[model samples]
Target: MHRTWAIIGGGNGGQAMAGHLALLGERVRLFDVFSDTVNAISRQGGIKVTGAVNGFGPLEFATTDMGQAMEGADVVMIVLPSIYHEEMGRNCIEHLRDGQIVFLHPEASCGALAFKKLLVEAGNTADVTIGAANTLLYSTRIITPGTVDIFGVKHSLYMAALPASRGTRLEEAIGSVFPNFTLCPNVLYTSISNNNAMMHPAPTLLNVARIEAGQDYFYYTEGITPSIGAFVEQMDDERIALGEAYGFIMKTLRKSYFDMYNSGDMSESDSLSALCKKVVAYREIKAQKTLRTRYVLEDVPYSLVALQSLAKIAGVSTPCIDAVVQLAHGMLHGELDEGRTCEALGIAGMTKADLLRYVS
Candidate 1:
């Protein structure tokens, strides 16, 4: 029954979500740490969402003020990349209230645990329930300063809360806003389900030459050749192995790619190169202009590193994951280690059984 929403991020997903929520007749406040985006949206008279979801929804409160953004809000949404999750939690922890619900749009690897760590470190004992979506509700891009192009909206998504006991309550509250959400067993269920980590890093990393050359080509179609697909398959094996260790099975990389752009039925080409030819949304998504993009910078650290570290807890070997990290370290000259770690996430020294009990 709570309708007041505070969306934290000015990225495409955040703007699109604000519009969709407003279309549902809910009151929304949007917060971005970036002042320029806040000022731009404010000066433009609100956000304009186009493509998949279209509308102009005025953010009731838009500011850099964490206090102003979070005050009186029923749900505070994290809509940015996982790289910002820790900082966001740290920034907003002081103002988080007892009944507030903080939702991570797409739970990247161990995101719920990392954000919750920030809260606990800040001494927050508020009855705040932390939850995360398995995948972003929308495939979107900010077309302009205050305009966003939404390509797709996920029909159904899984979400879960830490401490599992709060899952049903959070589910019912969010179900009012997005009726298709299904409550998952725990945060790792959603974290392991992240498709972006499986999809982004390899293709982008393998195509560094094209990206650095500022080449404009369809990333999936041209970049992820059958050869590169082999690397992705190897990486996926490492990821799936860790998940299997915990009695969890994640979608195969091929199935995930098909689900995003084609009929999700397992009838398509299993070859990643052949499968990329089927993606429609990625037709114009050119390679990054530099090796510094999140495909390498963020995912290698936050996504792959978190997974590999957790794999250690389960006594799982992630040689493929380590290979990518080693290669990225060579390319980036060592900013790679700064991403999320189970230790930094406060899950260090935990065994597989210990982690299950802790996250659950």
Candidate 2:
């Protein structure tokens, strides 16, 4: 079946999704707040995709107007950074219609919960079913204004709806376009399973001098040295402990990479750095040239800080996680705060069982 798709946020991930879906013969509209991006895409007549997927996906329309982009769409995919999740949610609340599915391409952590909170706070009862994926379906980057390079697509990924009851409906509605998603228990499972949080911040923080000095290096292979990789492993341990406190068994970052990319076998003796160096898709990916990048800004607040908040609620201590959060705050000059905390996500005082029941 052909579905009408409204792709919000015309950055790297959004362009890849809109272009790929259009290549599949689905009717697609692209939306972005930046007029420059909308105009550039419009001038090009379509998005050019290369590498793993190759095609020029001609969009039905490219506009800055939210209402126009979302009008009569069956699926709305928000593919922005988690920092913009709330802003996009606010922009979408007034435009959303009933029976429409709102999916965060990859909700850094607790994004669907935060978005659902915004909808209820505004009293917009549109019966919208909101869901989120653990990670993006493709490993891609934008080559230019209207062109993208997709390194690879994931073999499988996890997704879940806000209310546990709505998981089936969301899966059925999105199955035609996203058949690789495997439905999990609830939003907690999806949010707490975020591996980007485990991988991005520590390495970026450790490589601050290289980034500021404009050194070009492979982010995963060179940026993640043996010690940096071990530090990330410690943070990953805390993430797993957080999930345990909430009664879910989350996969380690190394194991998750193996599962998602089918990269290679994992020996119990392999170090995190060694495992990362073996991934073929990550070989050509370059490190950030500046300190003011998403690796720190987006992941620290949305993923790391948010995980710390969840850990506090679970009564689990995360010394390694806290250390990175503190360093990010100090180095970035207080810009990173307790973002998407329990209070912000509307689960402030809930116990572990209470959180389970709330999502259930």
Clashing pairs for predicted structure model 2, backbone only: none
Q: Model 1 over residues 266-293: C-alpha lDDT tens digits? A: 3566687787776666667776677888
Off by over 4 Å in 2: 212-214, 259-266
Each model's C-alpha lDDT?
0.81, 0.86
* CA error at residue 346 for candidate 2, angstroms: 1.5
Q: Which 10 residues in a row give candidate 1 its minimum summed lDDT? A: 260-269
TM-score per candidate, chains pooled: 0.93, 0.93
